[model samples]
Target: MLKFIALRLLQGMLVLLGIYAVTFVLVAATPGSPFSSERAIAPEILAQIEAFYGYDKPLGERFITSLGNVLQGEFGPSAVYANRTVTQIIAESFPVSIKLGSISLLLALVLGVPAGILAAVKRNTWLDYLPMSVSMAGICLPTFVMGPLLALVFGLILKMLPVAGWYGPEYVVLPATTLGLYYAAYFARLTRGGMLEMLNQDWVRTARAKGVPEHTIIWKHCLKGGLIPAITFLGPALAGIISGSFVVETIFQIPGLGQWFVRAALNRDDFLVLGLTVLFAAMIVIMNLLVDIVQVALNPRLKYD
Candidate 1:
């Protein structure tokens, strides 16, 4: 187990390095200075500014320096934001993203699991048909579309929830719901399929022959193995959520990492963009590792190595 974990961590480091290198190359190749603005600075002043940030160095040297700083967990300064480091900005904003993502994930699990269980158990009945249809619709609708329609119904016409801003608990409902519902649809479908497969297994037939109560057979015997597909999706879903959903954050005016992530790209804040990319890449690696570990634990037939 320790060796497996160690191997995965090593692989994760390599993946992060590759992601960092690729992002750096892309950012460097892109035209326009991070300092570009409406007003032009004097040549000498611009030279001094570039030299101050070590941008005056050759590309290879700059890349080496940036990589060293990244290894030490520093992301340098933000070019667009006058007095902030990339690290500082992430520190302030990542928690907001985490909060939103956590709630959204919780909501997905709460709503999706039951819906899936019902759909599977009910089979061809309306109970099965209704939720499957809704799940299909949810899958088809992108968050950009769902966010506004929800805002219109619940925020504008109903006036029950705020359309934008990251203020109180009330502010989170629409964004979280918008994000959660999409994944919930996926979870419902995955769970239903897994459960259906589990239900048809030989053990299930054996349990039924022994006259075990139907509900107990479904809940106790089937549920654990049946949830494997949902669990598989959970890792990437959690990582993506925690990294922040750019569209949802934008629509809802949330001051999360996603906001900075988008701005960093457009404004050519190189360090900030690199910092967020590395952070996101690292999260993906870690989450996938965790999912594998969890999957192994759940399935006794599976070996860690």
Candidate 2:
């Protein structure tokens, strides 16, 4: 297990390096300087400012310097934000993103797991069909569309929940639902498939033959094996939720890392972009590693390797 973890960490480091290299290359290749704005500066002044930020260096030199800084956990100054470093911005905003993402993840699990179990148990019945149909619709609708549609109904028409801002729990409902529903659809499908497979196994038949209660058979005998697919999907689903929050954040006016991320991309704030990318990629790698470890632990048949 230690060897497996060490190997995975090494691979994760390599992935982070590759991501940094690719993002740096793309940022360098983009046409505009981060300093470009509606207001023009004198050429000499611009040159001095560029030199101050080491932007005057060759692309290769800048990349090397940036990578070295990143290795030391220094993300450098933000080009667009004037007085802030990338690290400062992330520290301030990431909690908001995490809060939103965690709630969305929890909501997805709550809505999806029971529905999936029911669908699997009640196959060919309305109890199966209704939830599955709704989940299918959820899958079809992307967050960008879903966010506003939800806002329109719950916020505008019904006038129950607040449409925008990140002030309180009331503000959380729309965005979290919009982000969660998509992943819930996937979870529901995965859970149903896995449960169906488990229900058809020989042990399940044997349990039924032994006069075990249906609920007991499902909740105890089948649940662990049945949830394997959903567990496997959890890591990627979480990563997707974080990335997808960028759009949802915009639609809902949330003051989160997603807001900074989107602005960094649009403004070509090189340091900010690279920092956020590294942060996101690291999160994904760690989540996947944890998921793999959990999956192996849960199933005795699965070796760590």
Candidate 3:
């Protein structure tokens, strides 16, 4: 297990390095300097500013310097934000993203798993059809559309929730729900499919023949195996939730890393964009590693190579 973990970690590190290299190249290839938008500055003044930030250096030199700084845990100064570093911006905003992602994940599991189990158990009935229909609709509707609709009904019409702004606990509900429901639809379908397959397995028939209580068979024997697909989906899903919150955060006016990432891209804040990219890439790698570990734990028959 230790060897497996260490091997996975090494692979994850290599993946992160590849992501960083790709992102760095893209950012470098993008037209326009970080100071391109500045109004009517003297050429000498522009040159001085660029020199001060080491932007006057060649792209290769800058990349090497940035790589060295990152290795030492420094993300360098933000091009757009005065006196602020990329590290500082990430530190301030990541907690909000984490909070939103965590809640969304929990909501997806809580709502989706049960709905799926019920649908599978009650297959060919209204109980199955209704949830399946809803899940289909959810899969069709993108978060951009769904978010405003939710805000409109719950926040505007019912006055049950705020339309925007992430101030307190209540503010979390709308955004989290919007994000969660989208993934929940996918989860529900995956779960139902997994459960149905597990239910048809020979072991399940044997359990039934041995007179195991239906509920115990379903909950204990089937659920463990049924959940494998959902568990596997969680790794990439979690990464998506964290990085994809840009839309949700924007719609709801939440101050999270996703929002920062959006601004950094628009503003051409090279370091900030690269930092966020690396952070998100690292998160995805870590989550995937955890998923592999969990998969092994849940299925002793599986062995790590």
Candidate 4:
């Protein structure tokens, strides 16, 4: 187990390094300087700006410094928006993304698991049909569309939830729930399929023959095994959502990193965009690592030794 974990960590480091190199090269090679979009300043001021940030250094020196900082966990500074270090940007904005992603994941699991179980148990009955239909709706619609619709119904018409702003609890409901609904459909279908497959296996029949309490057999014996494949999706799904759902955040007027990313991209804030990409890629790597560990932990019989 220790060896397995160490290997995974090493692999994660290699992947992150590759991602950093690719992002750096891509951003550097893209047309112009980070300061290209800024209004004209005197050559002296420009030179000063470049020198202060080490942009005055040769490309190789800059690359080495950037890579060194990355090794030290420094993501660099935003040249345009916020005028803050990458760490500062993450410190300020990451909590919002984390909160949204966490809540949405929780929401997916809470609603998805039960609905899937019921659908599997009920099979083709009306009880099964309703949730499947709802899942269809969820899959068909997107966060951006649902976010505004939810805001309208829950915010405008009802005046119960706030339509915009991230002041408090009310602000999060529409956006998080909207984002969550999309994934809920995915998880629900996964669970339903996995459960159904498990139910058909000879072990399920044996459990029935032995007259194990139906609930116990279903929940205890069936569920754990059934959920393994579903667990595999969690890492990438969470990372993708956290990376910034620009449309959802935009429509909801939420001050998340996603919103920041979009505006930064539009303004050609290369440094800001690059910083966001690195942050997101790191998140993806970490989430995948966590999922791998969790998946192994959940199934002790699976051998890493």
- TM-scores, all candidates, are 0.96, 0.96, 0.97, 0.93
Q: Candidate 1, TM-score vs. the true structure?
A: 0.96
Off by over 4 Å in 1: none
lDDT of 2: 0.92
Q: Can you write out model 2's per-residue Cα lDDT over 1-305, one digit (the tens) per residue?
A: 99999999999999999999999999889998998788999999999989988999998999999899999999999988889999999998888899899999999999998889999999989989999999999999888999999999999999999999999999999999998888888889889999999898999989999999999999998889889899898998888788669999999999888889889999989899999999999999999999999888878899987
- For each candidate, what is the lDDT? 0.93, 0.92, 0.92, 0.80
| Residues forming the 10-long window of minimal summed lDDT in candidate 1 | 238-247
Top candidate by lDDT: 1
Which regions of candidate 3 deviate over 4 angstroms?
A: none
Model 4 lDDT tens row, 109-173:
88887888889888899978999999989989977678889988998899988887888987888
Count of clashing residue pairs in every prediction: 0, 0, 0, 0
lDDT of 3 by residue, 134-183 (tens): 99998899999999999999999999999899789999999999999999
Ranked by lDDT, top first: 1, 3, 2, 4
Q: Pick the TM-score winner.
A: 3
Better model by TM-score, 2 or 4? Answer: 2
